[model samples]
Target: MAISDFFCPQTTSIVAKRERRKEARPGELLNAALDLFVEKGFAATRVEEVAARAGVSKGTLFLYFPSKEELFKAVVRENISGRFKAWNDEFEAFEGNTCEMLCYCMNSWWERVGATKTSGITKLMMSEAKNFPELAAFYQHEVVLPGQSLIRRILQRGMDRGEFRPLDLDYAVYSVVAPMIFLMLSRHAVGACVPAHVELDPKKYIATQLSTILYGLRLSPGDMEPSQEIPQA
Candidate 1:
């Protein structure tokens, strides 16, 4: 074998590795940015910190993100907003009844977002959005509105199928969202201050909330199914 052939393959391998690394830079930066944004909040996190965490220079970060605001937007898109299309598709393809679908939706959200560090994005936005109006609007447009729409669709599915009674959807969506926001807040912020003796089980909490939403707090003698009975404290 010619010595040139061995050397040529090695050279090609090195070039391929470099190209792969270049392709991965944007994702690395986004992951690093998410970590910092979640830990430090948006205002406190610096662009240089994100680049350094990603093992890249500030200029390289700019090559992809252009500006800090844009970088943050990209991070939000990658972590949160990007999943909406797949979620919507899941809704379309779901085989379960609306009640089961609602349960699946909330559980899926917990698995995907609540159980992950990505949930901190919600905490970050809640704390910092008041100070950054532009980013707040962007978040509203990108995450909040779509999220509400998705929830409305879920509720509407229930109503249309007769699983749920007619509701004032404008207000009902907020009711559905309230517990989720509490869970996020509890996970990211409020849970920190919670007493160590008190165990906060998100899965159990979600189950309880779903039951309340579906069955209501009021129990008529005839209304309670044995399976749907709320366990007494």
Candidate 2:
């Protein structure tokens, strides 16, 4: 037992409880911030609201995050960018054909991120990035670049194995990514307004997208024409 416990058991218990709460505050704050940021976009979410949701004072939040921008950075790193290394490692260790790998990649992303509140980050960025250029630049550097690089590596792997046809890596990566962007936008931005009759099943949508992309990418020796840049109007 602690010395305080010896002196007064109840006093020690309260102190221990406070210490535990202190330790948990940062995580609680991040969770609260994420929920609010998703529900009310970044500009509308005040630091005070985050602290209140976390059951702390506004001053206490500053003690940990210093600024709203800093808190947001921490939240993005905690929820999204931090996982890139493990994902990249998974790519490196994968033994399947590139088609299987791409399928796994898309489905895994839906499970891990696309179907979660974390997906709101992309919608949030699309809506507010113009006003917060610094944060936008930070996100581009931390999330966008790494994500594109990972996709490029996947496409390159297919090409190297001769399973995928030769294509411009820069443009082809976006071709692979565009469907996912549409999915994110649909879920976070436009889903509420979309009619229920035609609502998409994300799993089926991804399967169809994967089938389409893989068909386009599969090697067909002497049958495919080289891609040409579109002429400017």
Name the best candidate (by TM-score): 2
Task: Supply candidate 1's per-residue lDDT for 31.
Answer: 96
Q: Which residue segments of model 1 deviate by more than 4 Å?
A: 1-6, 190-193, 217-233
Model 1, global lDDT: 0.88
Task: TM-score each candidate.
Answer: 0.89, 0.91
Worst 10 residues of 1 by lDDT: 217-226
Could you give candidate 1's per-residue lDDT for residues 1-233 as a string of tens digits?
A: 99899799899999999999999999999999999999999999999999999999999999999988999999889988999999999999999988888889999999998889999999888889999999999999999999999999998888777677666688888877889888887887754646556777999999999988877522334555535646799
Clashing pairs in 2: none
Q: Using lDDT as the measure, which candidate wins?
A: 2
Q: Residue 21 in model 2: shift from native, Å?
A: 0.9
The global Cα lDDT (0 to 1) of model 2 is 0.92
**Model 1 per-residue lDDT at 79:** 80
lDDT of 1 at 211: 89
